[model samples]
Target: MNTQIKGRTISLRLVRKEDAKFIYSLRNNKEYNQHLSQASGTVKDQELWINEYKNRENKGAEYYFIIERLDNEKRIGTLRLYDFIGNKESFCWGSWILNQDKTRSSAIESAMLVYEFAFKELHFASCHFDVRKKNINVIKFHKKFGAEITNETNLDLFFQLTKTSYGDFFTRNNKFIEN
Candidate 1:
């Protein structure tokens, strides 16, 4: 797996120990975490979580990344590709969090980077992720990517997207970010 993925306005690189603080902050920030499961851990606990995840990440069971602004080089978000499924050709995507100040357009570019990395770089056939039913904004955002709601649980809705759909989304919308 590639360690770094660059888009027109953002970059995604492997998460490091130093990111524990940022991860802790993002995971605990109400604006970003309220719709998701709460992360209950101290910074030391977060560091250990990073170490444990490092091994799993290296084995390709998961990919964790820190998102940074390309122009100013400011770290603004986090992302992950995990939960490898049947045939291992599809995976769940989550851990998407960005600082509020940078969400205007960088959010789109950041997600595009992950999609490009998964469908193009890793040759993954599709990707799936769950969003809380109440997170309407994010649900709408996923729909913009041609993701279809494939399932629903009491508290969450699952969206799935094939590589072809992702490709066509950008092609039709004319929003393809430079690789």
Candidate 2:
């Protein structure tokens, strides 16, 4: 699916094969890899992974997006949706703002765009994520989006956000004015 989500500071587009190097660099960051299930390595490895990701049937897997700075179109992060076990729900995962110099707001904005896409465009009943337990900032960030902890493993916390709750959050936040 050719799709794009525009945020105040960034735009998210489907991951392209051309993005292998950029993605490899971001995923190699020790801080970023701690939260990811798989470790990423060389550009060649990233290319192989992208090939598999692109060919996967949408019947189960949904979307994977590349987050880019709107001003200069520099690739910075990635967002993925998968594990569509049913019609109403799916798993959401992303790594944003790999640039250490960037503000947290950029990552948050990218996530909000993905959330909107999942709940609004895709019509998912709920979107969920598994975050590393030690990632306090991520847990708090998910909470800001009204996600609740549903389950926990030794190293991860599983969180869920229902469509209704997402709508309510936007209502209360009075529309996200992207900066």
Judging by TM-score against the true structure, name the best candidate. Answer: 1
TM-score of each: 0.94, 0.87
Please give, for residues 1-179, the per-residue lDDT of candidate 1 as tens digits.
Answer: 66778877778899999999989988988878888788996999999999999999878788999998878878999988899887757988898888965746787888888788888777889999999999999999999899999999999998999999988987765454664
Local error of candidate 1 at 83, Å?
Answer: 0.5
Clashing pairs in 2: none
Model 2, runs deviating above 4 Å = 38-41, 57-60, 95-97, 101-104, 174-179
Give RMSD to native, each candidate: 1.5, 2.3
Candidate 1 wrong stretches, greater than 4 Å: 173-176
Instruction: Indicate the worst ten consecutive residues by lDDT in candidate 1.
Output: 170-179
- The lDDT values for all models are 0.86, 0.74
